[model samples]
Target: MKRLASVVALAVVVLFGTMAARALRIATPAATTGTAIAIPAIDTAAAALHLAAAVRFPTVSLASGGPIDTAAFLGLHQYLQAAFPRVHAALTREVVAGLSLVYTWKGSDSTLAPVVLMGHVDVVPIPEPNLRDWEHAPFSGDTAGGYVWGRGAIDDKSTVIAVLEAVEGLLRAGHTPKRTIYLTFGHDEEVGGRYGARVSSTSSWREGSSRHSSSTKGGSWGHA
Candidate 1:
């Protein structure tokens, strides 16, 4: 029985190792010495700074005729365009309703269906005034006590920045994906997705997804 258990454990390890080896290895951005630079000058502190500035936009996307502040949301879009010039210049961007920001990076092969990486830009509304029970004000986007505080920071901005970081870093590194990559950031979520990115509303976000052979793959918020 002891010998049998040892054999089983060894077999399991070998099988798992083989399977993992077959998995595709994602290439990281090339930087300085040709080493994988995950992000171009990945400024952890600066990323937080950018998030803080974005939080200040107050992009609250509510339901239709539901007090959705289009102005604030648009402002955020402008800021991103201004901040990431390389991203804007390099990738082909499609904007729907001045809210949804969808960027498409043409892959080495257009034969493959596109993946829709989605998230929302508009955050939920904050109370008009403090309840006096909270320790930090929402939308502060502050790195307080080493914790990132904000409305969209955790919910989605993290993903947004991540995608941008990966792509931006990759671009700076001069790497490209074989399959198409589409980035979709919706405008509304808290209230409803009536205007949120459903992967069907925008043509670019879907990337001809309506086709029978073409399918869409995307990652959502809240994943490490």
Candidate 2:
């Protein structure tokens, strides 16, 4: 009887596995035009070019609140608007410090607390030996060698680009997450929030946030 019961259990497990494989095979791209109208993302080649152009916009912040690279910051902002036209056209974009950009995606339930994902756009001043230490120009967003090289290439800008890309891709695929995703890009986090005196300011941040899932990090992004 025991042997017979074990065989029955194994057979049931195999049946479930077969059903799962069949289900996966059945999942196909739905025939629809909903995604096609919402998002037309920039091509991968153009995306790489946008990253390169973004990295070239020198946005190193200062502590004394003196003159800043306003032109550079503004240019990057404009680049974002141009790069993710789907996002710019659909999501409401709010700019702070001429660089800090916040994009909010309303969720199915607006009553639930919003999830904020934080990143910084500004990079630290290039060290004196920065150019010598770098294989490519520090400010140059070189897309050569399968890499986007720059001071902030792998850092916050990547996060910014990623979130925008995800939204663009989702809107294109007509998919939406259950909860809201808030993107906060700080402009002066590299300078201890003292960039540009008191005229413009960067807010203080922590490694984690309580606004989102306890298991999931708020995604405090920092990379070389």
Candidate 3:
């Protein structure tokens, strides 16, 4: 009788396990083939120059919530407008919280959800004591050995410039996207996104705009 009871328990466990495996198989999604996209040709030297120039702006954000650098932020904005004329002419730009920038490139299809690309302009302040350890000045925006070096270059300024560059190139190529795109550049992200990203997000929410995809800066990059 004991042997029979053990066999019954084992049979019940196997039955449930088989059912769970079949359910898992049904829940798994099938892999689909993706279409390959043609890569566009870009002027690498011009892009590098733009990035180097961007690094020169000393848009520093302190953790203590200090007074904002109005000149630095404004200068950077002016530079961008000058650098990418096509983008300025094609997209609607708004200055949020007096510093953060929100640019909208309207699409043809209103039914499709919009896309948001985020990056910050402000960089953390370098400590006075750590000044001696630098190979290059933090705000020098130096381009040496085929690399753009400076604060904010990798953290976020790169993304900002890269997006603008792509947009400008696309505009030059007469390519209009089907889905709308938003380029959000926050000014006070190093401290916190309170006055920058939050305000922009709130405005979008109020306008009943839902994003289909969002991408941010400050991630790993491949190097040669």
Candidate 4:
């Protein structure tokens, strides 16, 4: 009985191994066309500076649902306006729920549905005990050792800055989109998106845009 069981187990393992090998052989990657499009160069130094500056704002959101730091968010808004003047001039911007922002870049084709891109500006508060353990000040926006160190540097702030930079660059190049684009920046995402994302979404819906594709705070992409 032992010998028969061993033989059966060996046969099962061999069968699975053969199946896996066959699957691997048939799972070859598709060939690429090898066509390369020329992308415009971006000013990395300036972008880094902008990101660092944005990180300086202590727009901390608490789980306790405390009062917001209005000054910080307002300061960030002013800085963005100064940094991307072209974007401000080309797109129509609206403040939602007193803190969140929505910018609409109307396209040439009215028939095409709009696209939405989202990010959050708020970050979780750093505990006082853990503050001493940080290599750099959480709100200092330190650019040292080839890295931007701060609270909102990686989360949603980077996404906001990146999208704005791309749009600003495109606007400078005089490139217009065929489909309308919406840029939504939520303020209270860390606590909950109630006053920020939810309101902005409703605003977008009111505009009659049915097709929605978005990239949210933690690099989550979805279609609605």
Backbone clashes per model, in order?
0, 2, 0, 0
List runs of model 2 lying over 4 Å from the truth: 1-46, 194-210, 213-224
Query: Per-model C-alpha lDDT, please?
Result: 0.68, 0.67, 0.82, 0.85
The per-residue C-alpha lDDT of model 2 at residue 82 equals 83
Better by TM-score, candidate 3 or 2: 3
Q: Lowest lDDT 10-mer window, candidate 1?
A: 211-220
86-179 per-residue lDDT for model 4 (tens digits): 9999999989988888899997887877888888898999989999999999999999998999999998799999999999988887878877
- Please, what is the TM-score per model? 0.71, 0.66, 0.78, 0.81
Q: Give the per-residue lDDT digits (tens) of candidate 1, residues 3-82.
A: 99999999999999887877646554564342343445676776777777777777876657866577788788888887
**How does model 1 fare in lDDT?**
0.68
Model 3 earns a TM-score of: 0.78
Ranked candidates, highest lDDT first: 4, 3, 1, 2
What is candidate 3's lDDT per residue for 128-155, written digit by digit as tens? 9998888999999899998999998898
Residue pair clashes in candidate 4: none
Question: Model 2: per-residue lDDT, tens digit, 86-201?
Answer: 77776667775555776766667655555666666787788785569888888978887888999788766776676677777777676664556666677787666443222123
Q: CA shift at 110, candidate 1, in angstroms? A: 1.0
